[model samples]
Target: MTQSTIAAPGRAGSRGRSLIGLAAFVILVDVASATASSVTLPQIDGWYAGLEKPWFNPPDWLFGPVWTVLYGMMAVAGWLVWRDRGLAGARGPLLLFGLQLGLNILWSLIFFGMQQPGLAFAEISALWIAVAATMVAFWRVRPLAGWLFVPYLLWVSYAAVLNASVWLLNA
Candidate 1:
């Protein structure tokens, strides 16, 4: 076979491996954020158990599965963007994604770890905005990526309301 033909397959394989590596890195980042937020799980049974949650507050058992799915979607969404537009090209959208992820962790820390639902309400409101912006940015890059974030944005919207209710009821 010609050198050009032989080298083409090697380049394709290298590109595929790089894409896979990028996907793994994105997933690891998201998992790390989830793990960081989970540090407050002990307080869920200790402190959160005593809070005056709204009538609509979901059962504790539901949170784990719901968050697992949401985080998976978030990782995929981010990877899709980066896959389409690399880091430099997708900086703004990725930054928005990171902001929302950080806000997600902060909300848990404030509400569960610090036992400050009031402060968490403010943080989650900001998170909602960040998620919305990230969703829009992702949509601009890849429509499917944007679609993946819909559930997350909706969930955060609901969580924001739930947080406000809990804060008001307890305060």
Candidate 2:
């Protein structure tokens, strides 16, 4: 067999390994954001428990499971985009994903950590826009990836209204 033909399988194997590594990297980033946001958990029973939440506010226990699923979906969405088009090829979408992720973490910090619902409402508003932009960008790259973000977008849309209500009630 020619040298080029002999190297084909090896290249394919190497590519597969690289893709796995990228998936791991993407998951790790999401995990890090989750961890950072978890820092406010201790405050929930204290500050958050005292807040005048709207009737629509979900039980505190529900948020953990819901966020876990959302974060998983986000990681997969990002990985799918990267897998379909490598980092360089999908830079714009990836950047949008990263921006929304950062904003996601910041919302937790501002709302729960600092106990500032008003400021968090503003931040989450920006986050809502970012998520929408990211979803559209991801759709352009991979339709499935974009679809994965739909639940997240809906959740955040609800959260934004919840935030506004909380701010208004408490203000």
TM-score of each: 0.85, 0.86
Task: Quote the lDDT for 153 in model 2.
Answer: 100
Give me the candidate number with maximum lDDT. Answer: 2
Q: Give per-candidate clash totals.
A: 0, 0
TM-score of 1: 0.85
lDDT of each: 0.81, 0.82
In model 2, what is the error at residue 19, expressed in angstroms?
5.0
Query: Highest TM-score, which number?
Result: 2
TM-score of 2: 0.86
**Candidate 1 backbone clash number:** 0
